[model samples]
Target chain A: TQTVSQSDAHVTVFEGDSVELRCNYSYGGSIYLSWYIQHHGRGLQFLLKYYSGNPVVQGVNGFEAEFSKSDSSFHLRKASVHWSDSAVYFCAVRRNNYAQGLTFGLGTRVSVFP
Target chain B: GGIITQTPKFLIGQEGQKLTLKCQQNFNHDTMYWYRQDSGKGLRLIYYSITENDLQKGDLSEGYDASREKKSSFSLTVTSAQKNEMAVFLCASSTGLGVYEQYFGPGTRLTVL
Candidate 1:
């Protein structure tokens, strides 16, 4: 079985400041890691995914994440956040095997203050 | 280029009533999934379908039933609504499964009174 964990429940940052949301996972075989963002009263939207080769993957809205195999972590980052960036971010992971579903983290709620 | 649509954005039902949520995806994906999102808890899979007319139960399939009548449409039914039970039901689809990227619909919020 695989599991995903988002350590921070809530994060606050001022507008124009950078932010990083931490995610960790526990798995044995090959895995795929990805991120999703959800706004209030909305469904989740895909951010980015890391399968193989590249350690850092870029997502929509200038968001990027780095995959650290040694650390078993995939952390999401944004250089500059606007007020619209305030949302709940989730980290998910799944095995490469066929038909296996994704395991999502509890999610990190981000609040941007202007 | 494709989108997922879930009907009845907000649903209010009485306890012990049977409620159904519908989902339609134009993505032409081979896999469809239903998930429940509760307050403070992340999304949990309720059911999934690999192809038309196929169904697979997930971790929280106990009080729920799912059906896939066609390739593009999937429906979920709550066998019995629990009082004060409120959560969001999300519908998603993927080209295949696992590593494939899944697209989600806006979701249907269910409130049981």
Candidate 2:
């Protein structure tokens, strides 16, 4: 079974500061790792995904993630954060099969202060 | 661009009452899913349909029933509502061929008293 883990439950950062959210996974076979962001009282929006190729992948709103096979991790990063960047971020994993549903982590709530 | 619409933004039901949530998507995707999100917890898949008239159970499908009568719609039914149970049900869809990105709806908030 594929599972995701986000160690930090909450994080605080100042506007214009860089932020990084860590994500790790445990799966025996090939899988897809992705990140999503959910604003207050809203549904989740896709951020980025990694399957193969380069370890680094860029996402919307100046966000990017690096996939590390050796570390079994996919961490999301942003060079600079805005107050509007405050949201709950989730790390999810799914098997290679397209029909399978995603297994998600508990999520990390990021609070960006101006 | 397509949109996913979920009916009854807020729902309140009594103990042991059966409740149903509806979802409609115009993405023309072949796969749709239903998931439950509790406060401070990650989402758990309840059901998914790969195509019209197709159904699959997820890890948390014991108390839920789902239907996909048409390609554009999928519905979930709560067999029995438990008192003090509250959650948000999210509906999502994908292209079903090989795409990994799934579009989600605003979700339906359920509160059982």
Candidate 3:
């Protein structure tokens, strides 16, 4: 089984400030890594995913993530955060196979202030 | 872009009551999933169906039942409601054809009294 870990439970930042959310996983075989955002009372919105090739993947709203094989990490980053970016971000992992649902982390709650 | 709709935005049930939640998707995806979310936590998969009448249990499938009546509709039933249980149920769908990305519904909030 695959497991995901989002070390930070909450992160607070000001508008225009940079923010980074840490994510790590433990799996022996190939896997798919992705990020999702959920606003208050809303469903999860897909951000981006990484399967192979380039280590850096860009997502919606100026958000991006870097995958590190040596570190077993897929950390999300944003150059400048907006107040609207304040939400719960989740890191998920899925095995590279069929008929499998994703295993999610505990989630990191980002709070951006003006 | 297609959308996923879940019926009854909010559900309140008595302890031990049998409650059902319904979901529909216009994406015509071949796979559907049901997940539960608790406060301050991430989602846990309850069940999934790759096709009509096909059910697969996930890590947290106990006390829940699921059905896929057609290509676009999937439903979940709470066999027995637990008192003070409050969580959100989310529905999602995917192509089931090698693409792993999924689309989600707004979700149904459930509260057991």
Candidate 4:
């Protein structure tokens, strides 16, 4: 069984401030990690993913995440956040086997104040 | 551009009622999945299908049934609604069995009264 852990359940930041949402996964063989964002009344959207090489991956809306093998973490970051960025962000891990499907974290709700 | 459509934006079902939710995708993806999102909880996979007529159960597949009638369509049925059970059912699809990238539908909000 695989699991995903997100350190923060909620985060609040002012506009133009940089923020990072931390995510860590329990190791269990070859793993594929991805981040998704869900706006109120909307569906989940793929933000980015990391498979191999280049620890850092860029996503839409100037969002980025770095996969750290040593720390077992894939943290989402943005240099500047806007009010529109207020939403719930989820970190998901897919194990080498499909029996687990996608293990998701409880999600980090981000509130950007202007 | 392709979009995933889930029918019945909102559903009100009585306890022990059998309800079905429908999902259709124009992406022609080969994989479809159903996930349940409860308040304050992350999405949980209920069922998945790699191809037409193929069914795969996920971690939380105890009381749910799913069907893949065609390559681009998948449906999930709740065997018996539970009282005070409220969750958002999401349908997603990917190009293949790989879980790298997936597109999600708007979701169906179920309210069991």
**What ranges in model 3 sit over 4 Å off?**
B97-99
Computed on C-alpha atoms, the DockQ of candidate 2 is: 0.65
Candidate 3 vs candidate 4: the DockQ winner is 3
How much is the lDDT of residue A67 in candidate 1?
Answer: 96
- Which pairs clash inside model 2? none
Worst 10 contiguous positions by lDDT, candidate 1 chain A: A95-104
For B17-91, candidate 4 gives per-residue lDDT tens digits of 999999999998888899999988889889999889999998789879999989989999999999999999999
Clashing pairs in 4: none
TM-scores of chain A across candidates = 0.95, 0.95, 0.96, 0.94
The total of clashing pairs for model 4 equals 0
DockQ of each: 0.76, 0.65, 0.65, 0.64
Q: Model 3: how far is A40 from its true place, Å? A: 0.6
- In model 4, which runs have C-alpha deviations exceeding 4 angstroms? A99-101
Task: Evaluate all candidate structures by whole-model CA lDDT and list the values in order.
Answer: 0.93, 0.91, 0.92, 0.91
Off by over 4 Å in 1: A95-97
Query: Compared with the true structure, what per-residue lDDT tens digits does model 3 show for residues B1-113?
Result: 99999988999999999999999999989999999999877899999999999999987899999999899999999999999999999999988834378899999999999
**Which parts of model 2 are misplaced by more than 4 Å?**
B97-99
Between candidates 1 and 3, the lDDT winner: 1
Docking quality level of the chain pair in candidate 4:
medium
Clashing pairs in 1: none
lDDT of 1 by residue, A7-80 (tens): 99999999999999999999887869999999998889999999898899999999999999999999999999
User: What DockQ number belongs to candidate 4?
Assistant: 0.64
Question: Positional deviation of B70 in candidate 4, in angstroms?
Answer: 0.7
